[model samples]
Target: MTINNVSLSHHGGEEASGLLEELCDAYADAYGVEPGEEKTVAFRRRAEKQFSRPGFALVTARDGGRLVGFTFGYTLPAGDTHWWGGVQPEPTADFLQETGSRTWVLSEIEVRRAWQGRGTGRALHDAVLGARGEERATLATGPDAAAQPVYESWGWRRVGRIPGDEGDYYSAYDLFVLELPVSW
Candidate 1:
């Protein structure tokens, strides 16, 4: 279906819970996986936890009430071992010292397969990141993921890679970070 008009809306973490299932389903479908699969299930669980973080933000794109795409993330606390520890080569001391206030981790951004290449993903991504108050944003993307180019085009630079954990879907992912434009 052609999306002639995609309307985007921003919602707080709690307010976005209602659409979680739909968002997860869209994510699975976009990647050609079933929602009940192990990786998808894990992703859903992870998303649920992320939604509870302080400053969590979600942006959904809809076409006449039908969900087309969505993106969400939360601020990363500095010194957080969970994320920084996973990097293959240790990050610079400055990068490791995340007090949890400087960076925003853009956890997920997905669009329905039917909606791919229509700019819906970009719209949703920009809507979420543009609204963020953090100084920089980070995300991990597999080298082969289609969205990698889109991210690069938007100024996300390759910084590093995280060696994939055993049983994870992808073997490794190139990490990307973007210094957000300071808004006056």
Candidate 2:
């Protein structure tokens, strides 16, 4: 079950703008990211870009008004060559193609430390994922992230490793993909 008083809800782009700070703040809490850290800043920037994309959406878990968790992503446009942020060994040309509605990228899913193991993250995940209308979905996860096991159990498969950017804050991550309408 989820933590007491937590409500899961949806937010579109307009509403999402007002929630960026709160969303990033909750992200910092969940990821142990220091204030003003490069990753934190980069996350905000990427989030802003995500907001501008068509079909951007956010799902949040709030404990009676306090942000406890969030997950967001958007459907990729017809051409998003940079979206992968660069994958190692590269993928086949066909695999790199996008039809604007073929893929949904789950950018980030975070649950604050205090809310861990109470089902908040899973509920948020299921809610947002259940809302997607794409043929497939993808996300990046660190080898040691707490959510990795859950993703694996839910049928997400490794695609390839996305190398970290120049900044050290962004470590290399394993890119994962799942076919749409996951049962779990």
Candidate 3:
């Protein structure tokens, strides 16, 4: 199924709730585990709060009225943004403190399982790159062979790795970076 008819739009707080759930569920499912009720509720709450912020933006894809995916990110204090923002169990102060300059951190990218290879992810990623020109782009994903190819294909270079606490949350993740030339 080619995603030739998909539409992309920036999502607001109220408009983002329902669709954000699908994205979060995609995250959990992609991790190969079922999310607990608490986890699901917390994910929505956090996403709502972030989406409420001024600098944060979400790009969503819809096909015939059903949402297939979305990507969201925010401008951090350069020294205060992590690849996943605050999604991980670890506090982001350390991650934020290590930074270069003028860049927006990609908080999340989610595409429905069925729509995985249809360019939904790239469409959303392009939105971010277009919105924030120049400044390096960054994100983290599983280190398994499956995710590496996608990151490389997207032009994201492996920069560093984020260590996580035990509990089966981030056992195979690695951080990747993309140096986007600032087009004046």
Candidate 4:
């Protein structure tokens, strides 16, 4: 696939209506779940509402006018460190509280199965973080050691992992951080 042809857009509010479902479906499929099992209404609702918040931003990847991938995040408030729901499990309040004012918590990054390994993920990451210089950006991913290499290559470091819910059969996750210089 020609990655250069993919366009990125910042979607917000009701504009995020169907995207939560799309992202969740892509994520669930990547973990080998059945179609029906992937459609969690509650998850979708929570994700949609979260993305609609003021500090949140969602970048969508489009190829030939079709949505292929997306990534979203927002500034972490001072009082609350542990934000729950959406694609990420609830983090500890202390884990998030130490971040500076520029702290960013990435909520999700997902590409359709057909579009994997095509640089869409990198494009989304770059588009999202490129504008914020010197801010600390963090994300938590389920135990997929393979993803660690990719993140490290992009300047992120392994920090820690919050315990996964017993309901999460995939694996425990790892938290990663990239302390960017305040040059931007």
Question: Which candidate number has the best lDDT?
Answer: 2
* Models ranked on TM-score: 1, 2, 4, 3
Q: Write the per-residue lDDT of candidate 3 for residues 74-175, one digit (tens) a residue.
A: 655544443444343454454445444455667677777777878788887786567765367666666674767877877877755666545534565676
Better candidate by TM-score, 2 or 3: 2
> Which sections of candidate 3 miss by over 4 Å?
1-3, 12-19, 25-42, 52-54, 78-101, 166-168, 181-184
lDDT string, candidate 1, 37-84, tens digits: 987898888888988897799888888787878889888865555666
Q: Lowest lDDT 10-mer window, candidate 2?
A: 162-171
lDDT of 2: 0.83
Per-prediction TM-score to the true structure, in the order listed: 0.88, 0.87, 0.70, 0.74
Candidate 4: where is the Cα deviation over 4 Å? 1-3, 24-35, 39-46, 83-100, 166-171, 181-184
lDDT of 4 at 88: 45
Whole-model alpha-carbon lDDT for candidate 3: 0.65
lDDT of 2 by residue, 1-184 (tens): 2446798889998888999999889888887887478777888988888887877889989997899999999888897656676787688887888999989999888899899888887788889889998988999877567777788887888888877767645478888889998786
Q: Write the per-residue lDDT of candidate 4 for residues 13-99, one digit (tens) a residue.
A: 566765666667755654456535734443465576677555677788888877788888777766635533222444455545643
The whole-model C-alpha lDDT of candidate 4 against the native structure comes to 0.69
List the pairs of residues colliding in candidate 3: 79-96, 80-96, 134-182
User: lDDT for every model?
Assistant: 0.81, 0.83, 0.65, 0.69
Superposed Cα RMSD, model 3:
5.7
Q: Candidate 2 vs candidate 4: which has greater lDDT?
A: 2
Query: How many clashing residue pairs are found in candidate 2?
Result: 0
